[model samples]
Target: MERWQRGDGRLIVATNAFGLGIDAPDVRVESGRGGRDGERSEAIVVMPAGRQEELQKKIARAKARTQPWKIQSRVMRPWETKQVEWEKMERFLSGSRCRRIYLDSEMDDRQDRKRCEVGEERCDVCEKDDAMVEDGEARRAAYVEEQRVIQEQAAQAERERQGPWVDSGIDVPSSSRNIPVPSSEVLVPGSVIVTSPQPFTDQDITSSEEEGRPIPQSQCSSVSFDQGFAADHDPVGESRMFEAQKQQRSQQRWRVEADSQREGHEVWNLETRLDSW
Candidate 1:
């Protein structure tokens, strides 16, 4: 076993004595009647029908050998325990119940009713039978899907409860007056300062007011600053600017639809535009 652990042997085939005190993490496959790490390990026990009779005969022989009064008490206790273990093994091998359930019942003293009651995948009996296993798999899949949907719904509810400005404490800006104009120079790495064509000046605002026509909010909204980490330096200003741009676009869309309706033209729809294209 030590040689196998040290990579001297790739495999080892021995009795139950070889497994005791062995702590090899990379031991993938082990075959024997006993000893396990209670992990994803496989234990295959091959017990012939005649083995029970043979074991009983051996126990009888041992008992007869130790029948002398002096050693009877010392030997009898261990032999009795072995007899009980043998009977349990025989019952497990012969039982028609799930192999895993049977093993759990014997090893951990767990009740059969509680073992794998909620869509366990497979066992000796389940693998041999197809219809029952398929039903169990379908139920497990549905249960997993249901749990995922519930989690997603809970996350959506939390986001809705928190609202749009959950991360930043600043409220969403509503108009062009609150929007911050981006500077010409990049203030942070990977930050692009997008400037609009025909920049809005005080003169332009005055001219629009004199003409009795409000300057479309979209003009101010088009100038957005990608400040990146610089936003952390001034979170309030950054959030206000982002919110103002968003509101400007929304208001501009509404105004466009209203203007189209006044002119007796159908509102610009994606399907109509695509059809024309």
Candidate 2:
């Protein structure tokens, strides 16, 4: 046992009578550790003839509070109370349906239990059940994965339809119609575009010019304010808004830039440019 624990021994050839039956924590860890590299592997527990009967006899004797011939080691405990852990182990070893179902039923009082399904790695009983299954396991796995992805997409769409705050799991009010999009999109040179954030687009400059109404990157304001609106705050007495090229939004100090040119970056930001006579 020490050699096995220390990686010295490669194989363990013995009955798993104590661990698999009564000791829940000790069972399956070593066997399951084989497929750690994400490859297909199996952990099989072999039961010899008359082994279960022997285990049953021992369990019965223990349940009856009969004294053993010799004192048990520290690992095996004396009957502290009527604990049903031993019985659970017995049922687990002898379960017919899904192994996970049995385990979950024990762990949580779960009535709506699920099996291994088509895509998952089957337990021993499940493998035996589908010994002559017509459908390929690989196909089943793919179908299961696809279903999961579809579910995630659906969840995201639901959140988006509700609101941005819904996706953030906050109770603050926000517009579902005007969800945020990227602002730092590149445009062609000589495209004197307006970045009024209502709706974002990538329309050709020439096409827009020919259309008579040059469509801007009209992504109207999408905000996630703790205690504020989309537009800036304005005071009643002081009117600093629209003083120059810059405009001070209502109820806010931050200045909205009409246009600013950086090195190798041309930005044309305005609401709409209608030639008024």
Candidate 3:
């Protein structure tokens, strides 16, 4: 005969479903399961004023013959399972301080293993779920750091690979009368200079004259231009600049997909926009 919030209530010393249609403003319901020898209590039935005593006795008897309550257990959601496996994979792949932090969050019973350091408990994802939380978090952090290092190394290598196209302080067209020496160099950074190669027109003419050969009247029919972007020739820094810009666009696209779950956009698409070099 009262009103209360959804889960708050007072103790009821009754026998039949203590809070059946209960709307008490303040109540704390407790079962006498331990105190009594499984005996019925005074609050076992609703004392309806007009009900016959015989009917009430019959209802109580029927209730006593029925089974008791059933309890339900909690289960993990699908996303939770996916996230855990992903973090596990991260821990396996990581190799940095970040990985250590993630691992400290995942495995709890590994205190004896000394898998994680002691003082890393204060990080962002480190505080939850105690020991396992710290382990998993450490693993993720390490994985992230390793992946970052690998990416940086790879990028450095790529730049090195593109080195030959940059200037290397080598003499090009400076020694006009000398026979040009052939270099054994593969492309590396700082090989090619931003300035265009010196024109070979006079050299070509001089060589042709010396060889008693006449210049052809027309350009060759089978020649074609390669429109590829060489990392060195780009005074505008298109390759590096555009690549960074593309990365930003890709991150933005990913964020949008996360929010809306829509398709038709991708990071690789922005990266592969080298049609015009």
The candidate scoring highest on TM-score is: 1
Candidate with top lDDT is: 1
Ranking by TM-score: 1, 2, 3
Give lDDT for model 1.
0.61
What's the residue-level lDDT of 253 in candidate 3? 75
lDDT of each residue in 16-92, candidate 1, tens digit only: 67667666576533342233544455555678767756755655566579546465565568778998787666545
Better by lDDT, candidate 3 or 2? 2
| Residues forming the 10-long window of minimal summed lDDT in candidate 3 | 217-226
Poorest lDDT segment (10 consecutive residues) of candidate 2 = 244-253
Give the TM-score (vs. native) of candidate 1. Answer: 0.31
Candidate 3 local lDDT, 1-277, one digit each (tens): 2323543553434454855665433332432221133333231323445444444454457558867755443676888779768645434342222433334445433333333347432322234335687799999999999999999999899668645333332223322313333334356687953432333477787888999997442122122222322222333564665565566567757887786643334544555676535
Model 2 earns a TM-score of: 0.27
Task: Name the runs in model 2 displaced over 4 angstroms.
Answer: 1-7, 12-37, 50-83, 104-111, 132-277
lDDT tens digits, residues 1-277, model 2?
6676666866777764523533322334445343435566566667887776776676566678856566446455556323557666665576445776765676557768667666567777687777746357767888999999999999889666644432243232334324456465457589866453344445565678888984554333444332343533334312332332122122123322322233214322222223331
What do the candidate models score in CA lDDT, each in turn? 0.61, 0.54, 0.47
Candidate 1 clash figure, as a count: 0
